[model samples]
Each structure stands twice: as structure tokens, then as C-alpha cells.
Target: MSSNKVYVVGVGMTKFEKPGARDWDYPDMAREAGTKALEDAGLDYREIQQAYVGYVYGESTAGQRAVYELGMTGLPVVNVNNNCSTGSTALYLATQAIRGGLAECTLALGFEKMQPGSLGSTYDDREQPMMKHLLALAELQEFAMPPAPYMFGAAGKEHQERYGTTNEQFAKVGVKNHRHSVNNPYAQFQDVYTLEEVLASRQVYGPLTKLQCSPTSDGSGAVILASEAFVDQHGLGDQAVEIVGQSMVTDMQSTFDDKSAQSLVGKEMTRKAARDVYEQAGIGPDDIDVIELHDCFSANELLTYEALGLCGEGEAGKLIDNDDTTYGGRWVVNPSGGLISKGHPLGATGLAQCSELTWQLRGTADARQVESAAGSNGVALQHNIGLGGAVVVTAYKKP
Candidate 1:
């Protein structure tokens, strides 16, 4: 397909809050984020020709209702849901509109108002979306924990048993992300914890502590996508960050065929998507200066290091021990605190990642900024995934 240059001209998000802690609904969340994004771009709601809104636990026309909070422009509003990757999926579609010349300007917005406690299916009348994956887990290990923690924790256990990865390595992810959140005003948890505290916290399953898992969150995020012509026409060149490459991959047969816990949680899908993004961007992992990867659980973060080609297979433990993924390391990852510390509102998570990377590439991220991304040649990568399953890998660069 033919494509045109697409750029993120503006981005905004609300401080992620524990669900029910905020007395807002999805529409309220949408208005704050959408207004900030429009103001950031120096544009009006009418200027957006289309919108894509993402959420997982809402009724029909929720997208339309949310968009109406911004304006009743009658633009086509597409509702999207792909489990945890919903936000970036909306982003992928909006970028496609600009890239395909279908729209000069578009809005990708995501918000979620979730119930507290561990995630469970809304409907038990039908088979769960992750039933197949659950069956695979049952065939391999005892299925005694909640679905989300069990699958992810089982993957971490497999990594430990197979690759000699230690529980401490996974716990470090929690420690680093929590520490990084101290500098981010939007993170849900800002207090730092020691490795002992993280490991000593309530154990969910395997090596995963309660501190390592993302909490149910209520928040919203929005990004404005513009074509090159639109950007230049509006004199918005200075703030535009280019979306150089992107790819989305779903589960493959190997996901179930491999009979491995890691594969069951989207390890292979992430690897394929990351490779495609690198090829499209004409750069390798070595070129990336910063990252905002999905760390729904600390275990997934470690698994993603190898999946994103940041290190060799079974070498994630070594990389963690060598201090290669934090500030002053080879690459600064999850500088926005990641989902573990930042809070995961499903639909809002990916847009939050995009906002952070855009700030990093623009050298506007304050205390959490990575020095490498503040340079003229800075490049950033984003990885967001959902099991049962899909993954979106994106590459961004300062324009």
C-alpha cells in the first residue's frame, strides 16, 4: 500500500488513578485528554476529520459518546477493543488514515474505567477469549491461580526453570519501574521500594509479587496524528514526531503448538512484530535510545527484552544483572514507570506509552527524560501487547 509521512503533532493524558478513586466516567476522561491534545496542536475539534476510540469494557456507541464529549462533528467514530492493546490498535488505525491519504488529521483516544480487584471475564455465558491458552497452561502446569497472574507467572517460572533466570531478576523490574515513577507525575505509584520489599510483598503466583502486577486503573490518553502536508500547513513542524515504522502481529500456530508458557503469553508475537518494526524503520535494537514497553507484569517485561531483540535468548537475566535497561544503562526503558508503577487502564496504556516517547524524542520529558533521546538523532521504540492475543511495536524519531 502507498503511504505518506505521518507524525504525532500532539499528545496528552490524565494522571492514572486507582479505579473508583476518581469520580469520573469515560466521557469525562475523554474530554480532558482530547482538549489537551487539541490545544497542544493548536487545533480545534472540528479539524479532526475522524476518530478511533478504544476501550475493552464498555457498551456499544461508547466511542461515539466519548467523541461527543470533544465535539458533535459527526465524523466517523470507530470503536476498538483488542484486550490490552486496544489503545495502540486505535493508534494504528488512525495512523493508517493519515498514511493512506484518507484524512489529513485524525484523533486516537483511549480511556478505561475499570472495576477493582484482579481482572475477570464480564461474561461467563460463553467460552473465555483466552480459553485455548488456559487449556495449554493446564496441560503443562497446575492451573490454580487467577488467569492473568497464572499465565504470566507461569511464564516467569518457566524462564527460571529453563534459562536459570532468577526471581530477583524479575523483582528488579518492579524495583526499577517504581523508582522511575518517582519522577513521573502521572504514575499511580510514586514511592520507591527495595528489592526485599518487592519480593516480600504478597506473592500472587510463581515469583510474581503483588507489587509487580499492574493495578486496575481509571484514566484516558489521546494523540493527534497529522499528515506531512497538514503539519507544514499548520506550521507545526517543530513539535511533530514521526512514526517511522509500526507493525501489529497476532498469535501464531506456534503460540499453541509450542506448548510453552512464554509462547502462551505472546512471546513469539512480540518478536515478530518487533522485527517488522525494525525492518520498516531501517534500524536495529542498537539504534533505539529509549523505550516504553508494556510491563503489565514484571515477568512480561523480562520476556520482552529478548522478544524485542534487546538481548540474546536466555540472556535477559544477564542483561538485568549487568544493569542494561535502566537510566545510565545502554537503554533507558519504561522511563514513564511502565504499567506496573504507572497503572494499567487497558485502553489508555498504549496511548500513555506514545505520549512518553513523543516527549522523550522531543526532549521535553522532565526528570524522567533519557539523555540519549534528547539528542538530535534520538530514536524511541514502543511495545504494547495483549494476550489471547496481539502485539503492536512502533518506532518513533525526532523530525
Candidate 2:
């Protein structure tokens, strides 16, 4: 199908914080991020012909309520919830609108005001969305901890047992990300930690330490997308970051049948999404100068390396051992400090990833700037996963 190209002309996000750190609601976070996005794009809210607002814990029509805080122009406001990937799902919808010529401009926004402590089910009356994953985990490991840490920590243990990935390697991710966060003003945990410190930090489950898991966060993120014509009309050439390739995938049979931590945690979905994105963009993993991906747990980040073709199976340990996934390495992964340090606010996570990548491509990442992205290749990649499960992988490049 013929399609108009979609480009991200502006992006904004609230500085992620721990739950109850701020008394503000999701709408308040949404307004701050949305207003900043408009100002970044030099466009008013009225110029946004449509919008997709994403959140996981909120009332019905929360999308409408959040965007209404921006200004009600009667624009279509779609509520989106794909667990943690809600932000990217909303982004994907907005991209479709512009690419399909349905709208010249669109807004993709996400926010969450989460309760403190570990996440819990909001609906006890209905079947859990993650029942399949949970059932598989029950067979593989006992649930002695919160669902997230239990699954992820078990996944880390499985990785170590299978691939000889040591706990030190897992702790290394938290150390690197936290060190990276020292330069990021928006990160919730900015203090740096040593490898020893990370490993010694309170163990949440199995090999997963407190420093390796993403904290419950309250935040919002928004990005403005425009068609080529809109970019030209608005003279947003310098700021625009083209959506070179994007793909979203859901769980398949492997997620249930494999029984391995990798498969149990939507590893196949990440692989499928990344493979398709690479094929569509006509670029391999080596072409990517920077990346912003979901690192809800250090284990997930390690698994993602293999899924995204950064390394071969069982080779992620070596990748981490050599420090190949950080600055001055083959690829700069999670230069925003990642979810481990930057904080993950459910729906806001994906859009926050998008916002960070846009800043990297635009060479405005401040101290976290990826020098390579400002060079000739100028490319960025984003990956977000929701364990129900869905995964979105998007490739971006300077226009």
C-alpha cells in the first residue's frame, strides 16, 4: 500500500519519580508532557488532528480525560492498554494515522500514577491477562515473590544455568545503567552504584537484586508525529526524526510451550518484532547508533540483546562482560539510564523510550548524548514489551 512517511517532530516526558513522590495524578503528568510536546513541535493542541493516550491503571475513557486536560478540540482520543507496551501501541496507532493519510498530525501520549510497592492485579473478578505466562512459570519455578520479580528472577537463574551467565554479569547491567543515570536529570535513581554494590543490594528474587529491577514510577510521555507535507509546511526538518521502520508482535505458541525463561517472558515476540523492523528498514543491528529499550529487569535486557540480533544465543553474557552495550561500545543501549534507572511507569515506559531516542537522534541527549548518532549514520532504535504479551520495535533515523 502507498503510504505517506511518518516522522516524529517533537517528544516530551515528565521526569519519572517513585510512586507517591508527587501528589499529582495522571492527568497532571499528561498535561505537562503534552504541553511540552506541542511547544517542541511549535504546534498547538488544535493542530493535533487525533490522539492516542495510553495507560494501564486508570478508569475508562482515561484517554479522553487526559487529553482533555491538554485542551478539548473534539479530536479523536483513543484509549490504549497493552500492559507495559501501551505507550508504543499508542505510538503505532498515531503512526498509522499519518502514514495512512488519515491525519496530517497526531499525538501519542502515555501516563501512569501507580501505587507504591509491587504491582498487583486490578481485576480480581476476571481472568488474569497473564494467566498463561503465570501457569508456565508455576511449572518452572515456585511463586515465592511478586509476579514480576519471581518471573524475571527465575528467568535470570535459567539464563545462568543454561548460558553460564554469571550473577555478576546481571548486576553489571544495573551498575552501568545507574552510572549512565548520573548524567540524566530525568532518571529517578541518579546515584551511581558499583558492580559489588548492585550485587550486594537486597535480593528481590533469585539472582535479581533490588538495583536490577525497575521501581514503580509515576510519569508521562508524549510525542508528536507529522506527515512529510506537515514537516515541510512547518519547517520542522532539523528536528524531525523519521520512523524508518516499526513492527509490533503478540505472543505465540512458544510463549506457552517453550517453558524456558526466554520464551516465557515474550522473547519470541521481541525477536519477531526486531526481525521485521530490521527487514523493513533495510538495516542490520550494526547500523543502529543508539537504542532505548525496556529493561524492566536486567535479565530482560540481556535476553533482548540476542532477540534483537545484537548477539547470538547464549552470547549476551559475553556482550555484557565486554561492555559492548553501552557508550563507546558497538551500540549505546538505554542511554537514558533504562527502566532500571530511568524508572518505568507502565504506560509511560514506551513513550519515554521514544522520547529518549528522539533526543539522541536530534543530538540533544545532553551528557548522555550518543556521539555516533550525530554522525553520518544517525540512527536510533526503541523496543518495549508488555508481558500479557506484546512487543513493539521501532527504528528511527535523522531526516
Candidate 3:
């Protein structure tokens, strides 16, 4: 069956921050972002036919709460939680619903109010006996290998060794992102940092300094998607951002269980997504002008460069060193300052990436704007990776 055409009509986001001892909750943030998106799209909440909300820590029926804040509506509300990829998954679901003719207009909302504490530890669910057993096993295995590297940190080290990536090089990622963040009004870390400062910062894990890690942040981002017919009817044809390709893949749950550090799961899934997008949009990665990849850690970005075929294996370091990935350069990556500087509120990140890309495609990203390499026909790629590199890639095009 031919895939139904879907278009993103509007996108909105709340500033990323630490909440600053406020009473504002996830539903409030979600409603605010969603309302802004609807306004941007020149549509009303009543026009929305379906909604998907992404949240990791929000209460059950959080999707309903957010939509009800706008005004109690009868739209079907589905909640999604897929680790860090929740936002992207929500977007994927909304796109599918519209594309399948199940809905004319759908809203994908991602929000999170980060609780103070180490989020990584929250994965251990004491209620789940199996999860408790797994945690114990993980702890025992960790003790067996002295300084075995923290879960994600170990992956960074492995990539570092294979790619000859250095602490300074990783520091550069933080430096560049922090600098970019200064231009982003909504970014959590707006302060710029020099490479020396980043290098001197306290190390959290191996070569990764505190600045390289994403902070626990509270934020929300929303995107409104409509069928091609809806876009045409609303006189929003010119504002429509087409959904060209989308794919998601899951890998082995245990990071330690994987025989190889660099799993093809993400790579293959991204490739397949890219292929589907290329086939549908008649455009390839080479044709993409801007990209936003999950940079929960600096190494994740490096690995993604290779995994996304932006460069070959072991060549991502060179890409960063040469400044090929920064804004205004060839194929700008993370022009919105990325998770490192923009803040990663878990569930909000994926939709935030899409918001940034939509801004770029609309030529609204003032200082960080690319030269419109794709011209009026701009293309963007959003890449999100979950725990152990569960991957999703979505491609967008503006015609």
C-alpha cells in the first residue's frame, strides 16, 4: 500500500531549564508547548484529531491531562515511554496515524519535569523481581571488572579507543555545543566554555567531563502534523514539512551481552530508514542540509556520525576536528546546541530535535541558520538512540 503523505505544520518548545523550584508540572508544560504549536500552525486545539504524548516520569494518563488542559476533547490520547527515544517514537506514531488515514491532524507532545537525582539509577525497578535480579547481576558484573566504566560511559570508552578520540576532542564537543547554546535562548546551558575549561572540568567518567553530560532538565516540545489534504485545505501547503522516512529498531537489552561494542542494530536501522526516506522523497543523505542526532554524551554523537553514514567508521573524530559538523559548515549537526548544551529531558529530546529542524527548514533559526543548501527544498534528519543504542531515524523534506 502506498504510504499516505504527512506534513508537520508547526512546532513549539519550552525553554530547557532546571525548573528552579517551581510548581509548574509536565501537563502545564505540555499544554503550553502544544498551544504554541497550534498557534504557529494557525489551527485550534479542536482541530486536532489525535494526540500522542511522550513522557518518562509523568503520571499515568498524562497525555489526557495535557490535552485536557487545552480543553477537554475526545481525541484519542496515547502515552509513550521508550527511554530517551520516547519523543521520537511519539512522533513516529503520530505520523503513522496520519499517513494511514486514521487521523487528519495529530499532535505529538513530549514533556518531562526531571526529578532531582541520578536518572540512570531509576532504571532499576525494585518492584520488578526480574529487574531486581538484573540489577544485582549488573552490579556483580561491574564489581568483577574494576573500573569497568559506567553503563553509557563504557560505550564511550570503547568508541574512543577504536576511533582514537581524545579527552580534548571530546572536550571540543562540549565547547562547541556550549558556544552554540549561548545563541539559543531556550537552551539550559547558555554559558560558553573554552576547550581548556572543558578539559579542566571535573571528569564524570574517564575522558568525559561534567560539562559533556546532559543535565537533568525540565522541558517540553510539541509538533503538529497534518495530512497533505489538511495542509492544502488550511492554506498551509507552503509551511508543510513532509515526513519522508521513519524507522525504529530495538537491540539486545544488556549492553554487556553484546559481543561487539559497535552494534549494527542502530547502523542498519538508520540505513533502512534513510533508504525508505530516500525512496519516498527521492533524496539521499547527501541531499540533507541539516541533521539533529541524540548527543546525550559526546561519544554518542561521534558514533552517530559514522552510524548515519555521514562519514566512514573511525572517521567521525576527523569530522569533528575539521569542524565539518558544526552550523554553517557542510551538513550542520545539532544546530540547536544538542542535548549536551540544549539539555536532554529524556522524553522531550526527540521532539525538540524535530522542532529545531523545522525552524531551520522554515529559515527561522536566525544566528545558527545554514545557507539553505537544500534551497526551498530543504531536507532534515532526526536521529534518536535509546538505552544500548535502540535507534530511530526520521527524515523530513520541505518542497
Candidate 4:
């Protein structure tokens, strides 16, 4: 017997903003995002049988805190924290619950109220969760930059050494994402920059300028998921977007065995996850019309292009140079601006990607909608990864 199919019937998120720009807390963010998602789905809080909330920096039961403020439904709320991928991990759980017949309707919510500047540890007394990853990274190389930048930067540098990808090509990604953000009302940064401007910005790490990095942000995003039966019961076929296929893969031996920074920073994991998702969906990368990828840094975004099989290995630079990753290209990527401009609020980033993809698939993205999305034949792709480490790749199709 096959597992029941799951679908996303509603998705919503608050506009991402700089850390201090918002006068709101996580609960307030959750209240608005969750309420919007509930309204989008035409359902009440009481109708949600379960809730999975994701956050990185919060007290225990933060899930309960966020949801209770939305309404005292007293649902089985589960809190999740999986580094940057927390949002989609929550989403993964909700999809599983519905697919497993444990719940007919579920909510996956993610929120983060982050501090300004580059990320740092909140609790230093205990062992860092990424100590092992750092140890593995040390065996290969070390740089003066912080661990996050060093890992991803080292990966980019290695790609340059091996593939001859230029710093300008990487900057082009920042330019494209920022330009794309100009059409995205939810993006934190809407100002467009020329490729030269992007290249001249303050450097964050090797080949990555400040413009190429995703800033610490404050935001919340949520999605309502339901089973086919629930969709049929509620007559939600038109609003639903089927989770065509999904996969979550962790770091394999290649992360350490290959002794490559790219592998250490999640290239291999993303590769495996994308392959699994495509196989499950019975479709290839060429079938995808639009994408919301995890571009925490431009380097990752370019590397991801090759990892996702959008182009031949080491050809991502060429792909970007040819403008194949933007509008009027093979795929319209990061139409919501991706993390580089959309803002990455740890746990909230993944669900926000979901919101963007659902809108694109439904042809409801307004100004950001891709030309391919007009005929309602759009198939959206999502990629979200967190180092130390897990990667989730999902495919969505119009209902």
C-alpha cells in the first residue's frame, strides 16, 4: 500500500526585515504568519490537528508560545531546531504526519528574532554542536574568517581552484538576486546593484562580498499541510499544491573523505538530496520552471546549480554568465530573492521559501511570477540546507 499523498493548501510569511527594523517579537511574527496561513487555507485553528514550530534561539516550548498566542487550540505542538534547516524540518514532519495518517491537517511554522551582525553562539559554556564539523574542516584547511564564512568561503575558493570560476561570476549572483528582490515586496533588500557594485562591496570572505551574504534577519513563515482526503472534503483541489516529491539527506563520507571544502559545506548532501527528490518525482531538473534555492551565500547558490543537476559539474559559472538561472532563462531562480536578499532568519528561511514556491506554482506571485508560471504549468523546486548538516530538496506541482 502506498502512503497517502500530502499537499500544501496554504502558505504565508511576514516581510523580512533587518534585525532591529521590526518592533515585534517572535510571537507577534508567528501570530501574523500563522493567522495568514490559516486564513489562506480557509480553516480555523481548531481544524489543525497538529503543529510543528521551528526556531533556533528560543526557550523550550517556543512552539507552544507562538501557537498559543495565535489561539488556544491546545493542539499537539512540537518544537524543532535543526540549525538553518529547522523550518523545512518542521515542514517535513507535518508532511509525514499527514502522509502517515496520523493527522489530516497540520501546521508547520518557523520564526526567528535574531541579533544583528554575523551569527555567533548564544551559549559558549557547553560543547558546540558543530565542534565535529569544525574538527573535520580543520583537517582540510583553516582561514582567518569566522567558521560559517570560512567553511563556505573555503568551498568557493576551492571551486575557483578546481573549476576556474571567477569572483565576478559569483558577484553576478548577488546582482541577480538583488535585482530580483526589487520586484519582491517581502524581500529585506530591494535595491538593485550592478555587477561592478556587487564586486566592489566589502568582502566577507574569499570571493564573497557583504552583498553576497545573507544577513541575520527577523522574520516568520508558516504553511498549512493536508492530506488528499482533507483536501477533497474541503474542496480545496484548486488551492492545493502537491508535494510531488521530497528528500532530506545528511552529510555522507564524501564530506570528509574527499577532503574538499565544497563537500564539507554541503555540496555532496545537496547533490544526493536533489537526486533523490528528482527520482521520486519522476522528473529531472529540466522539468522545473522556477526555484527557491538556499543561497545563504552566492557561492553556495552557484555550487548548488551544479549540485542540483541544473548544469554539468563545474559549469555553474558558465550557467550564470549565460543568465540561465534568471528570468527568460531555463529557470527563474530565487524569484523571491533567495536568502541573499530575502533575508535568512535561521528557522524561518525554509518556510519562507515554501511560501514563495507555492505562490509561484499557483500563479499568484503577482509581479514576481515567472512567464512559465502563467499557463499554470509551472513546477516549482525548493532547496534548503543547514550545515552540520542536513539538506532538504522538494518538488511542487500545481494541483
For model 3, the superposed segments whose C-alpha errors exceed 4 Å read 21-23, 120-149, 252-258, 264-280
What is candidate 4's lDDT per residue for 192-260, written digit by digit as tens?
999999999999889999999999999999999999999999999998999988888888888888888
lDDT, candidates in the order shown: 0.94, 0.91, 0.77, 0.91
Model 4 earns a TM-score of 0.98
| Worst window of 10 by summed lDDT in candidate 4 | 137-146
lDDT score for residue 171 of model 3:
79
lDDT of 3 at 312: 84
Candidate No. with top lDDT: 1
Number of the top-ranking candidate, with TM-score as the measure: 1
Ranking by lDDT: 1, 2, 4, 3
Tens digits of per-residue lDDT for model 1 on 1-399?
Answer: 246999999999999999999789999999999998999899999999999999999998899999899899889999999999999999999999998999999999999999999888999899889998999998988997589999999999999999999989999999999999999999999989999999999999998999899999999999999999999999999999999999999999999999999999999999999989998989999999999999999999999999999999899988778889998899998999999999999999999999999999989999998988989999999999998899999999987
Candidate 4's error at 306, in angstroms?
1.0
Better of 2 and 3 by TM-score: 2
TM-score of 1: 0.99
Candidate 3 lDDT, 53-85, residue by residue in tens: 998886788878877877777878999888788
- Sorting all predicted structures by TM-score, with the top scorer first, yields 1, 2, 4, 3
lDDT of 2 by residue, 1-399 (tens): 235889999899999999998889888999999999999999989899999999999999999999998898999999999998999999999998998889999999999999999999998999988887888898888877589888888888888889899999999999989989989888898998889999999999978999999999999999999999999999999899999899999999988878787788888899999999998888999899998888999999999999999999989989988989998899989999999999999989999999999888888888999999987579899999998889999999887
